[model samples]
Target: MKKPASAVPAKKRSFMEFMKRREGQRGLVIVLFMAIPLLLLAVFTYIPFLKMVQFSFFDMKYIGDRTFVGLQNYIDVFKRDDIFGALFVSVYYMGGAVVQLALALFFASLMVFKVKGDAFFKGAMFFPYLICGIAVGFIFKFFYARGFVLDSLLQLLGMEMEDIPMWLQDQRINNISLAATSVWRYTGQNMILFLGAMMSVDSDLYEAASLDGANKWHQFRYIILPSIKSIVVLNLILSISGSLSAFEPPYVITNGTMGTGTYFVIMNRLAHENQKVGLACAMAIVLLAIIILCTVAQKLFFKYVFDDGTADESKAAVRRRKMEEKAAKKAAKSGAMAQSSVSGKGGQK
Candidate 1:
């Protein structure tokens, strides 16, 4: 059977109409503009990510023959207790990140209400972030060294050497100290980000809330937090992933020694020092999966909890009630029909 000419041209005509639309033309232009960056991302990010995933499935050193090992590499990651123990170090970093965010939020909230020397304080706070990671590590190493900067400052505050504890030597405290360095480095950045988010919020809203007898805390809770929820959530996600992959402070200061080895540091050592590249790749893949899972979980959690899924919930509840009512009515009707049929049959009998 021959296709109708009209039908054949319909798809083409629709496409032509779409192309003729101004919105379609603008979308095409936007896509054209995005192509280069998309290509670069695919080449740089996605290609490497795929290669890492492939590497996870193989047992191969950097120089040796690659053999398919399937899940062995992944299994190896869990079999060793060190990998899990290394993850425990992330707790310290995560705790520090939370503290950093809290401090940042506190400072940003206070500073949003017009503070004296704001620029100076902002600059001072942000300066550490501007410093190179290695330089910061070196600086802190010296600062935390015995009878050095931190110790000296503490001594001036009337703490004796006997009373003071070693910052980097003690396993119990070294991870905390290292994590603090990250907090010191990142807190200002988070504060600035939060301050920016807060500033963008409608000033009129705050004024109106205040006019309605809302206090600072009330205003913050109802207005500022809601406005900056996305930013806060984003920072938290980044903080979580970054904490899990912490490497620089421990690498530069403790060199992954004294229980300061984070997941990435351990992976780094496994890959380079131990030359167990496949195992390291598997570890990396696992960590990446964990990070992705955490991010997805946070996004879904926020969407459900804060993104007002109430409409959907209410709609679902209404649908369920309607379904139940319909089923009950149907059942009652069926029962009545069956009873009438039985009575008719009996009467006939």
Candidate 2:
């Protein structure tokens, strides 16, 4: 049986129509599957964000009557300079974050060297990351107390109290001590992240470099670093965010005091002492904005500066070539049609 002429065009649907029909059904199924979680996220996460913004505007009195004071709550913290302590504490935490990331990267690189007991060592390194933040805070507090008390062996070596700074008490030394503990605790996790990235690098690159008379340092600088450049940005963003919002370590160590710990950071100051919820929220939002800006800046910087230059430029050149080819094809098709029309007219005559 011959099919109707109208059915031929209907059967040959446009590519866009085919895609829309296929994707529409698939998208409906995906949306259905995702709907419950989306609803939960909207209710929990987005609702809280809206509430925080709402609270940023008002100062509620203990009495039932609520008065909207506009941006006064935000302004008051700056006017009093009480927020400076929070900023200080945040910077203190950031110091720890840097130390942690550096040590983690270093140790992770060592693991990638295929040392003996690699699995055991990697596990040991990552063990601390599994611990609760509050627990880490308490454990380190004890370590700080025993600072120079381990002088039995040190005494034999003629080392004394002068060698160990009063870690918990003296404000100047305390923050640094906190940073040291943080590095010790967090380095393992970072090591794992870096090690995984390092593993993905092509082994042939190392072999080629070795054959070219490149030393360990030369290979690391030229090949290893370039390959893991993306990981650096990832770790940097994580480190920066962790440092900025740091709350647990300083809060637990200082027991909410002013002088000796990361209580100087805004999270501690706002939560424990000043109770400036509005100011704290403002500080948090500002910190979040800074982190986002820095992340974007890092991404842009890495894409341009640290990228495998040849790959990006080659892809761009390829795209240009394809565009030129397409244009040439279209022009050739038009010329062929014109020639065919002229021939047809001569035959008709």
Give the winner by TM-score: 1
Candidate 2: stretches off by over 4 Å: 1-28, 61-63, 146-157, 260-276, 304-349
User: Every model's Cα RMSD, please?
Assistant: 14.6, 12.1
Residue 24 of model 1: what lDDT?
81
- Which regions in candidate 1 have their CA more than 4 angstroms from the true location? 1-39, 306-349
TM-score for candidate 1: 0.77
Q: How accurate locally is residue 32 in candidate 1, as Cα lDDT from 0 to 100?
A: 100
Per-residue accuracy of model 1 over 174-195 as CA lDDT, tens digit each: 9899999999999999999999
Number of clashes in every candidate structure? 0, 6
Per-candidate local distance difference test: 0.84, 0.67
Q: What is the lDDT of residue 196 in candidate 1?
A: 89
lDDT (Cα, tens digit) per residue for candidate 2, span 189-275: 888878777776666666877899998777667655655666777887788777666667767876645453342355545644656
Top candidate, metric lDDT: 1
Let me know the TM-score candidate 2 reaches against the reference structure. 0.73
